[model samples]
Target: MTAGSHDETLAVLTTACAAVGLDPSGAKPIRLAENALWRLPGGIVARITRAGQHQPTERELRLARWLSAQGLPVVRPLPGIEAPATAAGRPVTFWEELPPHTNGTIPDLATLIRQLHSLPRPDFPVGRLDPFVRIRDRIDAAVTLSDTDRDWLRDRLADIQSAWASLPEGLPECLVHGDAWTGNVACPLAGGPALLMDLERCSVGRPEWDLVSTAVKLTTTGTISKTEYERFCTIYGHDVLNWPGYDTMRAARELRMTTYAAQHAATNPAWRPEAQHRLACLQGHNGPRPWKWMGIV
Candidate 1:
């Protein structure tokens, strides 16, 4: 699909609002990444996906509904709508808009992660947390690669996968928030509690996979302070860096981060340097403190 412009989001929002019987004029953009999100009138949010991505969109809605049924604090789907309504070649789903709040912090993230890790496994089967699969898919989807970069990435993925497979499983497995980084978490209305926001990656997997993103960010990028990192480790009750498989886990996380940037680098020139920087850092070309990363959006 073409890189989505605001027009795509507007079209989806219009269709979604009409399906649910609301005005489309008030829909406002929330974010754009794997999916586009917009806040509509009357406390509803519409998530718009690429055209023909029916199955994955259905899975996301199912996961969100299941999480809500389990009494986990998540953004709920709009009432009285059979979702994934088609709109201008995209699948649009609506969610209950979260009340006014800021993005969550590490502690908030830790709380949500702990809650998800403790919950009983879902009755339905969900995907496993496979970093290699995601990394490989990202590399394949990325259109910005030089032939040399592509070969190097595949070689790196192979090495990481071998390491990932060989390492001992260090954490008890359970349902995990696939991408548990701070940005995906949100502080609740009136400071009730922090809640998980993005359900796209919700699946059964090792808890370590959820923790790896934050740990690696603290290690490779100086974005968050060491104190904050220690606070996360303290709250989560496991310093993932000390775990035996941490190198493999961190490598996998770094690759995912790099390739996510590379996937957008083709059309977003700003992401090219950031992607290359992450790739170089993973290759041990960067040293010590402060490997800055640029955000794509």
Candidate 2:
């Protein structure tokens, strides 16, 4: 099923809900990106991903349980439900809906990353961080990209891949939250500790990989103020920007973000302008670092 098909996603949600004995009548879509998230009745949230994602989906559930057991704060899978049920070729999992929460503060995310990076590796197999995963496909699927722009993106991707392979050593490898952004960290409004959400990318990798997500917000995207960025570094106890390999990591991350926008624009035309802007920034049309990039969705 296409990632942008709302009706088709609803059908899959309905089937998955039926399988789990839940009503989908009033399900509300929370997000539609790599995964489709629906807020359902009874404080349960459902996540649906493309077909063939069952393994990773199951790993996310298991990882959540493990993290919770480790006394780490993570969004929990709904109890007593056999999840990753397949419907319409999509994999579905259920999670307990969090209380009304604000997006996490930069410091909140920093703390979570520190905690996550300190954990011992999981016993189960977690594939190494594939920074380039699905990137080529995203480029190819970007309907908004012109042939010339597509070729440029492909060349950029190749260069970044080479750079990534030769990245200098920084921090020791640990459990890295593959995507550690404020959006993935939730601060409950009802008086509770902040919780980490989205385990799809959690894996064992260099802690620098997690730290760079926030670092680039300051150096590349210009989203966070310097004071906030400094606070994040101090709280996390390490500044990725100070690491020798920061350049390569930053380039890889920027490329990924740009391609993500391009891929999204293919499905949602409203994102085309931002996607084109990101592409142009990468191509040097915008000049130098710290280009302003609006968050996409």
Candidate 3:
């Protein structure tokens, strides 16, 4: 997160805690991005998200409660409390703080994902994945990008949107952890196995879409070792690359990742080079794999 936004988060945290009669003093900041995360001394984690993100925040709370009822090991919002209150006009939520543990591994993630996919769909409203929603914002946020770059990005987004519309179903559409990836899973929980977090994009979609994140990390970036990649497939019981519609989905995923980095470059200049490299690679001027993607604090 940028330095300028830190104060705003602290101020919002204070106000929100005061409204609930919870102490905000000595709260520790965890992450600051689309949401501002703070860990309160009372062992609860507070999430302050953008005001426009209210609906998703509400959906997330519903999912959390649902997961808990299913005996899932995922995190849960605070019980017996009204949530998603406006803190400085931003939506804020409280979660039960989990005990410290090692970061979840790819195998751990695959196991959790398998369990998640097995469940019948919840009664709550959930639509299919929408990869195009962030395109406009990401494009507009690239304030310093060249006109040519901007044009190319817009064209790519348009092409992907069209392609996504007709994507053949390889795996049966299931309730996926929409943003499933190693980053979204936490290690063995206190009473359960691997834990999945980040339910913002939880929706019914191609099961393969969730696996694309790992596939990209392995094939496109080569950040993950081949042995590990194979293990992921073995555990998950399918190699996504061999799926007929894999390339199409992978391409769309790459474009979204590229656009995400590009959008952040406007506020964090360090993201520009990586963003440019990603765009160039997509255009076939392939840079070496295992890109050093960093700098979005």
Candidate 4:
């Protein structure tokens, strides 16, 4: 789809900038991420998103502040600007922008991911951290799938269900960056080390959950090597067998993503191409079975 009209799209950014006491006119937007990304002068990034109702801005701000306090390399939030409060509207967060990242060396990324997963897993007082459940619920709520797609999803999820059903309750859990893709990671910052962004999906869950997503991201990007995968397993201190549960969740996650893409394709046809690419990947069209993650760890 065509990019939104400059004035029209800028209206949202303008409001967000005004809230932060920044002059939108002076700051030309430069970059955007998967979500609503806007760049301002002086290396500032404003991310306006509307994904979850759980106060993403607040959660992210807390994570950023916590990581910063711990001396972990993390993006710092700009002070003095409260992400706009719109009474249940998703909050927009502003962050201290850094320089462009060098995507070349990824060795640091493996190390950083290990550190992130090392964070103490806190008990969420509100409820259990169940990514699979959330994904399943979304699939149920998503639009009706085509007959062929429905059957494929059903068979895949059934496999996941059987695997999950056999797992004992109270599996060892840890705090993991649920979406630890390469894009979420960046080169070392001049002042510090490499930082991990997109903590919005962070949660306390089985460690394997992080591994599965990380593997999928790496595999899709053709960056993961067998040796590196083994190193990741050793670093995380997890048995390779636990991959079953994670693999199941990963496939389900893809199904949920496909459903979301189906909706977005209505306005952005480009999304359709990406969606097909993901669909083929999930279906194991060009490589080993997607279930390969189940036992390989």
Candidate 5:
């Protein structure tokens, strides 16, 4: 709430730690987003969220544990600790600390994606994400998108809707590590390779959805060359379409992100500028042509 005072935040963390039978004597808070995360000396972390945000935080922690159960290297959350009731009366949760992987090399990164793709789709309707729903929500949340940019999303949505029936379906939907960007992945640790964190976005969907998300992240960040987009498909062994309806999803992703950035701008101004920049690029008005290097004129 009011910028999270150190003493008050520490009290919250201490409560969480005590509930889990750990002493919070020397714990220091680790900044993970707007929430406060405290690290005990021995691989224990308590994440405290104020009222209203606790539910999502709880969901994220559970999802992380579920992913860990699937044997996909992920941070496992400690179970059964109700979020400490603060003056705001919100729920908080804690999780076991995951050591960082020191070897987040390119080969490891490729292997990680390959392993994730190999896993079968998780059964259960976690959520539904359509282009229009995503775009509309972002717009409703007051994300600033130029008229042309908004029009671009509309055209992409129309294309996907029209081609929806023709697109592959029921091939093999599997659990996607939803937000598998490098930010959620850490370098190699122990005898294993890279580790993944932040599973709040996990869902059952076409494997290609995750692949496309990963590819887009890499593409947008210049982590991989434009040519590598096709290489990724080849390596991951998925159907490569002319566009694979990426424009549709990209627009949706940008919209959601822009909304989030705008909502959090007061405390995170950096994100607002980034959101504006991304909005400009998606509108095709103020950035390099993302599809140009792919020879799309």
Candidate 6:
């Protein structure tokens, strides 16, 4: 029942769809990262998470309902379906498919983030953020990494963990979207309001944890223009770069991105070059900041 291979994933999808009384005949894979997503017929998106993820998957559904109740635009779970169904030992949830949409603009993302941060914490236990979640596993499971490189990454992870523990006083803790990249926020092509997608990592943590993603893109990868970054800062109110703990957070984020690529590279060899480049930059083998790192799918 392990849903690693495409065939296994399809089997899980089929079982889950049957449980919900939906046909899986034309389910097409939309993405395969943290979760295996499939675009089901009739404008539904089915998500299958790794085995033993039922709790978080349930939490995601609850949070989505809560956010929508609070008048915040978010991707909604499919109506009339009891989600987080146990399917082939994996957790499966169905969502209402979003219309054609583009990646949210920097300002759109900043506004949504600010709005999200302004809300009071949820009534249910949303759990505290664990920035290091799955990090060590990624390091250990990355088959493409050499033992020397693995040791270096392990040491770097430890250093960052210590740094995180003693971060300088900054903004108050609140519900932070653990991953706030532009892609996670969808801007409807039909000119409707932007919607926040991907709720699994929604948890309470330092607001800076959310902001660091954009800051890294600006300073480390040079993906966003300075103008866009400035607008993001102005909209979000209070620049993350000015915070004393910015460097530590940035380093932690970069390390996570590196390990993520490395983990994926282990599965898809095509990703090895980008993964190695990212690791080299962190190891100081590639020259200083702004290494022109490309985004991996």
TM-score of each: 0.89, 0.96, 0.93, 0.74, 0.70, 0.96
Residue 192, model 4, lDDT = 50
Off-target runs (Cα >4 Å) in candidate 3 are 188-192, 287-297
Model 6, span 37-156: residue lDDT tens: 989889999999999899999999999999999888999999887558888689999999999999998898899999899899999999999999999999998889999999999999
**Alpha carbon deviation, residue 278, candidate 1 (Å):** 1.6
lDDT of 4 at 241: 43
Give the per-residue lDDT digits (tens) of candidate 2, residues 52-117. Answer: 898888888999999999989999999998568899888999999999999999999999989988
lDDT of 1: 0.80
lDDT of each: 0.80, 0.89, 0.82, 0.59, 0.57, 0.91
Model 1 poorest 10 in a row by lDDT:
1-10
Q: Please state the error at residue 238 of candidate 3 in Å.
A: 2.0
Where model 1 places Cα greater than 4 Å from the true spot, the runs are 1-4, 140-144, 288-290
Angstrom error at residue 49, model 6: 0.7
**Which parts of model 4 have CA positions greater than 4 angstroms off?**
5-8, 30-34, 51-54, 82-88, 104-106, 121-171, 189-192, 217-223, 234-246, 256-264, 271-274, 277-297
- The TM-score leader among the candidates is 6
User: lDDT rank, highest first?
Assistant: 6, 2, 3, 1, 4, 5
Over 239-280, each residue of candidate 1 has an lDDT whose tens digit, in order, gives 888888887887787777888898788767888888888778
**Backbone Cα, N, C clashes tallied per candidate:** 0, 0, 2, 0, 7, 0
The residue-by-residue lDDT of candidate 3 on 204-291, one tens digit each, is 8789988888898887777788999899889888889888777778888788888888888888778888888777887767666556
For model 4, the run of ten residues with the poorest summed lDDT: 288-297
Q: Could you tell me the TM-score of candidate 3?
A: 0.93
Cα lDDT for residue 61, model 2?
91
How do the residues 209-280 of candidate 5 rate in per-residue lDDT, one tens digit apiece?
Answer: 566555655555454665665566666666334455665555444555555554454345455566566555
Model 4 scores a C-alpha lDDT of 0.59
